[model samples]
Target: MAILVTGGAGYIGSHIVRAFRLAGLDPVVVDDLSSGHREFVPDDVPLIELNIVRTKKLTEALRDHSIEAVVHLAGFKYAGVSVQRPLHTYQQNVQGTVSLLRAMAEHDIDKIVFSSSAAVYGTPDVDLVTERTATHPESPYGESKLVGEWVIAAQGRATGLRHTSLRYFNVVGSATDELYDSSPHNLFPLVIRALTEGHRPKIFGDDYPTPDGTCVRDYVHVADLADAHVVATQKLLAGQELEPVYNLGSGDGVSVRQIMTAVARATGIDFEPVVAPRRPGDPARIVASGQLAARDLSWTMRHTLDEMVESAWNARHQS
Candidate 1:
């Protein structure tokens, strides 16, 4: 039996695939490579360059590899972009998730680990967001993710399929020396792209309620996030009590300027930032208390902001 990962060629999915390989498990990859790079997957891991929406091809891949469980990471994620193309986002994220679940059911492969997001919890009245926080997503992207989680929950409850939804904030940094960091949407690489290339990074929305008046977000390293996936899988494989939702984050929130400062310190480029208006539907603060993950999965973030930025910088420019 093998583990099949959708979007395995993408940033987070690739790292998770790396973790699975490191843990002595082979993962079959199915990615259309729309945004994911083909080079992300290793030579040994078989890659099926197919979209999840294509039910016929997906089912064949599952049966061919004897797939036991799936890590669903195939979806678009950009708040502003989603707002512009809400219809496209819904069809891709929501419809695609539903199709994957149905395909898994048909193939008799039930176990699944979903890659959820903190965006599900919009700017709540509560500063620190927990899993119990009302999922009042302001953007279509968040709503699509929430819907995806619901699909997993409803399917798991209805069927014998066991599922764990890992809802966390931004995915940062790379594991190992492969220099696995590159996404236009993520801030770290964008900042590094600007600084190393002698351009000023733009800080969107400078006057938020945060201390630095930018946006504050829960940043978790990619390796730590991958570790949680492995631990979560082990828990389910060991027949441990199932947790519907467990967050993965550094408990501490990092602001925009704070990140820039770290970048400046690490790269020795104390450059002025270009400030811009905030994107619509952006939350002022988002911090996570990953105690539940710590208790259950023995998961903890091992990398600091400096480590994250420094490593990301090295990966983007150095490598």
Candidate 2:
């Protein structure tokens, strides 16, 4: 039986697929190729081109691949755009999660590592968020992820499904040049794209309550993030119990201005970023402790801020 990765052709998902392969585990991919690239998937790995919402096809693929566990990373991932397209967000994230759960139930594939987001906390009141932090999702994307977590938890309680949700903050950097982040909405890609195209990157809001005015977010390397998923999946499949949720964070906050400066330093391109009004549903700051993940999944910040910027810059150029 092989492990299944939903949305495995996407940037982060592809990295996780690489991690699993490095660990000597076989992984089958199921991606619709909507936002994901068909080439991102390794040639040796099986790629099932289907959306998770198509429960029947997904179930068939699960059965065909003899899938033992699922690392679910598929969903609508844009937090800013989710505000304008709440219905689409819910349909993709919430309904998609429900359909995946149903398919898993049919196949008795009880193990799952859900790809959650820090948006579940919305604009947190705490300086450092923990698993115990109350959820107050501001955008439909955030709301849908929180609801997905709820649904998964409910399924676990009802069916004894072994599961865990990883609430990650801003995911950046890359493990390989061939598998760079391709999301047009992500900050790293946006900045890299702007600079490459001879345009100054724009900061969404600079008047926030952050130290540098721009928003403060917890950034974690995508490679490190992917490793944690593999570890989580291994532990779950081994019949080890895990926390219902864990935050994969660095326990440090970096503002948007800091990121831009790092980008300039890494790329040797110095240009002032244009300051624009804050996007709706944006928070001034939100960082997490990652203490739980560190203890359980051996999660740690293996890459520095400059390293993150440099690696991302290198990968984008090589790709």
Candidate 3:
């Protein structure tokens, strides 16, 4: 049975596809190509170009590919933009998840690995966020992801579906030259683009009460994140006990100023970042401990900050 990777043409999804193949598992891709690049998927892998919101096509693909489980990664993932487009965000993240769940239920594909987000913690006051943190989401994107979790949990309760959601922090770096983070809203891309375009990268606010007076966020390597997903899927398939949710985070976080410095060092572009006012709803610090994930999913920050920056820079230039 093949593993269905929704949004497999995307950055993280593409990496997961490669990881699955490396583990000797067949992976069938389903992507709409909205933000994903077709070239990212391997030529040998079967790519089904369709939106997950289309229940009929999704169900057909699931059955046709003999999919045993799904890695759900297709969704509108911009949190700040989601605030302005709440309905669209809900329709894509929440309703799209509902459609996927319906198809999974119809086809008797009872196992799923959901791609959740750390945004659900909204501006946490805690020093280190854990799975037990209160989920007071601040944006429609976060709320929709939280709702997606609830949808999966509810399905599990009603239909005995085996499921687990992986809440990702600020994901960066690349595992391969063929794939890189392409999200326009992501910091790595933004910095790389700015340097390539000969523009000074802008830092939101540098006056926050952090050690460097900038916001601190957990930045995990993309390869590390992908490895956790593969391990989680393996555990579910083997019917091993697993947590309903796990956080893939770096125990120690890097500050925005630190990121700027790293980018300069990696790209060999030394230019002062334009200090702009802090964006509304920006938190001073939000880091998480991946102890639980480490214990169960073989999660670890295998790449150092310098390694992450260098890999991302090289990939960006290669692309």
Could you estimate the TM-score for every candidate? 0.95, 0.97, 0.98
Candidate order by decreasing lDDT = 2, 3, 1
- Please report the candidate that would top lDDT against the real structure: 2
Estimate candidate 1's alpha-carbon lDDT, on a 0 to 1 scale: 0.85
Per-residue alpha-carbon lDDT of model 3 for 261-316, expressed as tens digits?
A: 99888878879999999998898999999999999999998999988999998998
Off by over 4 Å in 1: 177-179
| Candidate 2 structure quality by residue, lDDT tens digits, 1-319 | 5899998999999999999999999999999999999889999999999989999988887777788899999998998889899999999999999999999999888999999999899888899999999999988999999999999999989999999999989999988888888887889999999999999999998898878899999999999999999999999989998999999988889999999999999998989999988887677888999999999999999999999999999998998
Error of 1 at 224 (Å): 0.4
Please list the residue runs of candidate 3 whose C-alpha ends up more than 4 Å from where it truly belongs after superposition. Answer: none
Models, CA RMSD each: 1.5, 1.3, 0.9
Error of 2 at 148 (Å): 0.8
Q: The CA-based lDDT of model 3 is what?
A: 0.92
Model 1 RMSD to the real structure? 1.5
Q: Estimate candidate 2's alpha-carbon lDDT, on a 0 to 1 scale.
A: 0.93
